[model samples]
Target: MEIDQAGKTNGQQPLFPTPSSTPPPPPPPPQISLSLKRLLTIVNCLLLCLGNAGGPIIVRIYFLHGGHRQWLSAWLETAGWPLLLFPLSLSFLYRRRSNPSAPAVLITPRLILASAFIGLLTGVDDYLYAYGLDFLPVSTSAVLIATQLAFTALFAYFIVRQRFTPYSINAVALLTVGAAILAMHASSDRPAGVSVGGYWKGFVLTLGAAALYGLVLPLVELTYSKAGQPVTYTLVMEMQLVIGFFATAFSTVGMIINKDFQALTREAANFGLGETKYYLVLSFAAILWQCFFLGAVGVISCVNTLLAGILIAVFIPMVEVLAVVFLHENFSIEKGMALVLCLWGLASYSYGEYREAKEKKEQIASPQVQTSAV
Candidate 1:
C-alpha cells in the first residue's frame, strides 16, 4: 500500500509512484505555420476579390435588365448556399481519412445558434442592399459599401479588441471622403428616371446595410472565439452553411409576404434581357453572392474581420471599372478621384501590414538564432 498525493491509500503499488494530484498539463493548442496561414489568407483574399468584383455587377445587371423584385434579389444572395456542400464533402472525406471515427459534424449546437442569429441579421442586410440597388448605380453603391470598412473598424475595435494602425486609419478617412464625395452631388449621377426621394432612400438604405454588415463581421469573429469546438476551416464552412440557410429562409418569408415569388414568373417572362437571360441572371446572382459570403467567412477564419473588411474596401474600385465596361455606367471625374484616393489608402494599409508581418517574423527568428548560438 502506498500513500497518494491526495492522502489516499493505493492498494496496489506501482513500479513508479507519482502523486495523484499532480495532473499532467493540458495539451497546447495546435500550431500552424505562418507561411501556411499566409497561403490560406491569399487564397481567401482571391475568393473575396472575385466575389466582391463580380457579385454586385451581376446583381446590378438583374435590375438593369428588368428585375423589379427586391426580395427575390435578396433571396438569390443565400439561395446558392447549397453549393458549399461540394467543398464540405471534400472536407468530410479528408476528416474521415485522417480519423475514421471522427464525428459527422464538427460544429456544436452553440455555434449553430450563433450562426443563425447572425444569418438573420444578414437577411436584413440583404434586403437593405437589394432595395438600395434598385435605385442606386452599382458604382455609387460600391463606394458606399466601401464605408463598411469604417464601420467594421469601429465595431471590430469594441467586439474583438482590434487595434488599428495609422495606415488603416488613413484608409478609412480616404474611403469616408470617397463616399462623401458622392453625397455632395447626390442628384448629379442619378439614373435616367430615379426620383430624388428614391435616390436618397437608396443612399440611406445602402449606408444602413454597410453599417449593419460591419457589425455582422465583428459578431462573426466573436462567434468564432466563443465556439466551444475547435474552429476549423471545415467547421467555419459548416457555420456558413447554417447561416446561408437561415438567411435564405428569412428572405423566403419576405418573398411569400410580398408575393415576390408569384411575380418572379411574370418578371422573367418580360425581362429586358430576355426570359432566358433573366433566369440566367438569377442563377448568377445566387452563385456569385454565395461566393461573396464564403470568401468573406473564409477570410475571417484565416485571419480577422478587419483584414476581410480591408480586402473588400480595396477592390471596390474594380467594381467601378466593371460598371463602366459592362454596364456602360457613367464614371465621373469625382469617382475617378475617389478611385485614386481609395487606391492610395489601400496601398498604405498593405505596406503597414507587410511591415508588421516582417517585424513579427524577425522577432521569431531572433529567439531561434540565439538558442542555436547557445
Candidate 2:
C-alpha cells in the first residue's frame, strides 16, 4: 500500500512515520583509511613547505634574471587570491547540490571586519616579503623568516592562551639565537650587487613581515572559534576566500597607485626569460602560494597554530639547501650551525608533544583500570 493510503486506513497512524518514530540512521563510513589520511596529510605538509620556501626563491630568481620590478612581482604573487575562487566555488557547488539544507556559513559583520583587517595585513606582509627577497639572498631570507616561529609563539600565548612548556620555550630561544647568528653574518657576506645597507633594509623588512604574520595566524584561529560552528573544510576555505579577496583588492590598489600595471608591458619585454617565461614564472609562483596558504590553514585546523609555525621553521634548512643548489647562493658554516639549531629546536618541540600525549593516554587509562579492579 502507498504510505498515504496506509496511514488513512490506520486512522490516527501515518504511513510515513514522523522522524522521531524512525530508528536513527547508521553513521557514515570513513571516507579513507586512517593510514591513507595520514599519508595525505604528510604530503600536504611537504607541499606547504615547498610552496612557502619556493615562492621566495622564485622571486629571487626573477630578480637575478633581470626582473627588477619588485612591486610588480609582489602584486603578481597576490594573484593566488583569485585562484582560491576555484576551490571555493567547487566547495559551494558540492554542498548546494548534495546537502542544500545544510546551514550556510554565518557571515556576521564582525567576521567581515576581521577578515578585512587580516587581508590588509597580509597585503603589507606580502610586499615586505618581496622587498626582502629583492634585497637579500634566498638563504639569508629563509633564515630570517624562520624567526617567525618565535613571534608566533609569543602571539599564540597572549592571543590564544597557548601554553609554553619548557621544551617550547627552549625551541623559541634556540630559533631566536639561530636567526640572530645568521643576521649577524648577513652583513659581512652580502651577495654580489647587494650593498651592506640593502641587506640590513631587507632584514628589517623581512622581520616585520614575520612578526605581522605571526599575529595573523593566531587571529585566524580566534576567528574560527568565534564563528559558532564546527570547523569544516568548507568553512576554512570560506575564511580563506574572504581574506584573499580583500588582500587581492589591497594589492590591486597598490599596483594602480604605483602605476605597475602601466609598466607591465615594458617589464615583460625586457624580462631576461622573455614575455612567455616571465608570465609563466609569475603564474607558477601564484599557484604555489595558494597551495602554501591552503596547507597552512589545513594544518592549523587539524593540529594547532604552534605546530604549523614549527613545521614552517623546520623546513627552513631544506629551503636553504635548495637555495644553494638552485640559486647558487652561499651556504656558510654559520648557516650550517643555524640549520642544526633549528632542527634541534624542532625535535625538542616534537618530543614535548609526544610526552604530553602519552601522559594524557595513561591518565585516561588509569581510571578505567581502577574501575575494573573494583
Candidate 3:
C-alpha cells in the first residue's frame, strides 16, 4: 500500500477489499475488459445454476440408487478437479505466449496454503452434505440448503462488515423462519426406509453443511482480498484447482480408511440404476460438483461472497423441483411452504442489493454533476 509522489501504490491492490478509514484508493487501473468481465460473469452464473440445480439431484441419485459410502460421495464432490488443469495449462501457455517475461505459474505459496485449509473444510462440508442426503429426501435437503444465505449474510457482516439493509434483515428472518417451519414437521415427511433417528441426523447434518458452506464462501472472498495479487478468473481457477485437490485428498483418505474404494464394485454391481448407469452417475456427479465449485469461486471473484450465496439460494427451488421430477422424491405441503418462503426471502435480498446499488450510483453521479456545474 506504499505510495510515492506519483500517487500509485507499490503494487496492485487486491480486488474488492472492504473500505476502511484509510485514504481513498487511487483510481482503479484499467484491468480486465468490461465486456469480457460481463461475459465471464454470465458464464459463471450459468455454471452456478448448473451446479446448484444438478449437483444435489445427482448426488441424491447416487444415494437413492444404493450408493451409501459417505466418503465416496464426498470424494466425488472434488474428484473432477483434474478437469481444471486443461484450462489452467492453457492459461499458462497463453501467458507465456503473450509475455515471455511473466511467470509460468500464477499460484502463490501463501494462496496455496490458504486454499488448502479451506479445501479441508470443504471436505468436511461435503461429508456433512452427503450424510444428510443419505437419509433426507432431496426436496427436504434443498430447502435446508437455501437457509445458507442467512448464514452467509451473518458471516459476511462479521468478516467483511457487509452493510445490511432492511430488506436483507427481512430476508434473514424469513429464511430462518422457512428453515424452522421445516424443522417443526421434520419427522412427518421422512423418506421411506429411513428411521426417525436417521431423519433427524440427516436434518442436523444438512443444516451443518449449509452453515459450514456459508462460512466457506465468505472465507474465499477474504482470501482474494489478502491474495496480494490481481484477482482474475484464471487465478481464481488456479486457486480452485488447489482447493479441489486438497479437498479430494482429504476425502480420499477417508475412502481408504472406510474401505469405500473396495466397496465401490459391490455397490456398483448391486446398484438399482445398473452398473453402467452407476459409473455414469458418479462421473456426472464429480463433473457437476466441480462445476459448482468453479461457478461459486468465479462468482466470488466477479462480485462477492453474498452474491454467490444468493445465486446458490436462487437455484435451490430448481434443485427441489428437479429432485421431485427426476428422483420422484416426496414433496409434501410443508416443503412447498418452505420453498415459497425461501424464494420470498431470496427475492427480498436481491431487491435490497439492487436498490442499494442504484442509490449509490445516483450519489456518485450527483457529486460529479455538482462539481462540473461549479
Better of 1 and 2 by lDDT: 1
Ranked by TM-score from best down, the candidates are 1, 3, 2
Task: Give the TM-scores of the predictions, in the order they appear.
Answer: 0.90, 0.85, 0.86
Task: Give the per-residue lDDT of model 1 (tens digit) for 1-374.
Answer: 66676554677445555555477775554676878878877888887898889889999999988888999989999999999899999888887997787678888888889999999999999999999999999988987898899899999999999888887788778777876775565567688778999998998999999999999999999999988657777888899999999999999999999999788889989999899999998898898888889889989988789888888887877898899999998778777777788788778888888888899999999999999999
Evaluate all candidate structures by whole-model CA lDDT and list the values in order. 0.87, 0.78, 0.86
- The residue pairs that clash in candidate 2, if any, are none
Q: Please, what are the lDDT tens digits per residue for candidate 2 over residues 313-345?
A: 877777778888998878888778888888898
Instruction: Give residue 22's error in model 2 in angstroms.
Output: 20
Please state the error at residue 238 of candidate 3 in Å: 0.7
Enumerate clash totals for all models, in the order shown: 0, 0, 0
Most TM-score-accurate candidate: 1
Model 3 TM-score, 2 decimals: 0.86
